[model samples]
Target chain A: MRLIADLFLVVGAAFTLFGAIGLIRMPDVYNRIQAGTKAVTLGSLCLLIGIALLYPAWWSKLLVIGVLILITNPLGSSTIARALLKAGVKPWSKASVSQPGEADR
Target chain B: MTLTLLEIVALGLLGAAVLLSLLRLILGPTAPDRVVAADTLAVITTSGLVIIAALLGSPLYLDVALIYGTLAFVGVVAIARTIEGNG
Candidate 1:
């Protein structure tokens, strides 16, 4: 049981590590948000499940925490991205990802 | 209780990842980038708190994690609203 819990924790942490790396490596603010939000959200879920498995008594509390995270993380990220776009932060363009719009233009 | 091998590895990984996100928070090019990194860090902290609760064999830590998760969302929303209104 402990081993399983540890495995989940480690895997969750690994995903977080990857997300952080992507946050740094990706070009532009929007790309960073894209890389960071999804990985961290999933990683947190794995961690919550691992903790719940390790401490069965805490399952109910962990469930609440997990649900809150599931709801909030993406909502927050999208809000930030939308605010950024509204504020005129441009996405990385043909110089990086090669947009079809740029090709057409 | 003392740390076990797997917990140590897990903690190491999480700690490293937290540091990585902090690096972005420091170096992010724009306000939104910083906000995004901060949001990621907050979620990861909640996850770390859960792992800590397991390591400590205490449910109290879990409650703290839950509270922190809720507050983190509020914080994000407030920041986003402010940025949208001002920036």
Candidate 2:
């Protein structure tokens, strides 16, 4: 049981770290929001579960945290994305980029 | 005792998820993108903290995790409203 708990903690931390890296690497706002919403939400929930396992006494608290995370993380990301869209931030037209043509310049 | 295979696998999966999140955060192009990434990271942190506490057999950490998660949500909402109102 302790081993399982440890596994969860280490794994959860890795997920959080990965999310942070994504935050630093994604090419556009929408992509970042998508990545953040998916990866971090799952990662956090896993981590919390791991923690709960470690301290069975506080399993209730861990559950509360998990539920709160489930409710809020995606909602917040979506809200921000909506605001960004309203602000007229267009999505990336293509996966890659190119310089403006002389005709435009 | 040596780490079990199950533990290793769980850690690896969690790491993969974190890496994915990191990629999003780094490559995000706009302010709102970063904000979303931050919010996501906050949730991840809350979860990681709870797990760490559990691994250490510390019940007190669970309370912190609970409070942190709730507060992070509130923060996200406030930020979202601020951005929307400004725009």
lDDT of 1 at A61: 86
True contacts kept of each: 0.80, 0.69
By lDDT, the best candidate is: 1
* Model 2 ranges with Cα > 4 A deviation: A95-105, B1-30
Q: Which ten residues in a row have the lowest lDDT in candidate 1 chain A?
A: A96-105
TM-scores of the models, in the order given: 0.91, 0.73
lDDT per residue for candidate 2 within A1-105, as digits (tens), equals 887776666666566656666666666777767766776777777677775675576767667777888888888888887776666666765534553531211
Predicted structure with the largest TM-score when compared to the true one: 1
What's model 1's overall lDDT?
Answer: 0.84
CA RMSD, predictions in order: 2.5, 5.9
Q: How close is candidate 1 to the true structure, as a TM-score?
A: 0.91
Which parts of model 1 are misplaced by more than 4 Å?
A95-105
Q: What is the lDDT of residue A43 in candidate 2?
A: 71
| DockQ, model 1, C-alpha based | 0.79
Q: Model 1, B1-87: lDDT tens per residue?
A: 676788788788888899999999999667777888899999998988887777778778888988898899999989988888886
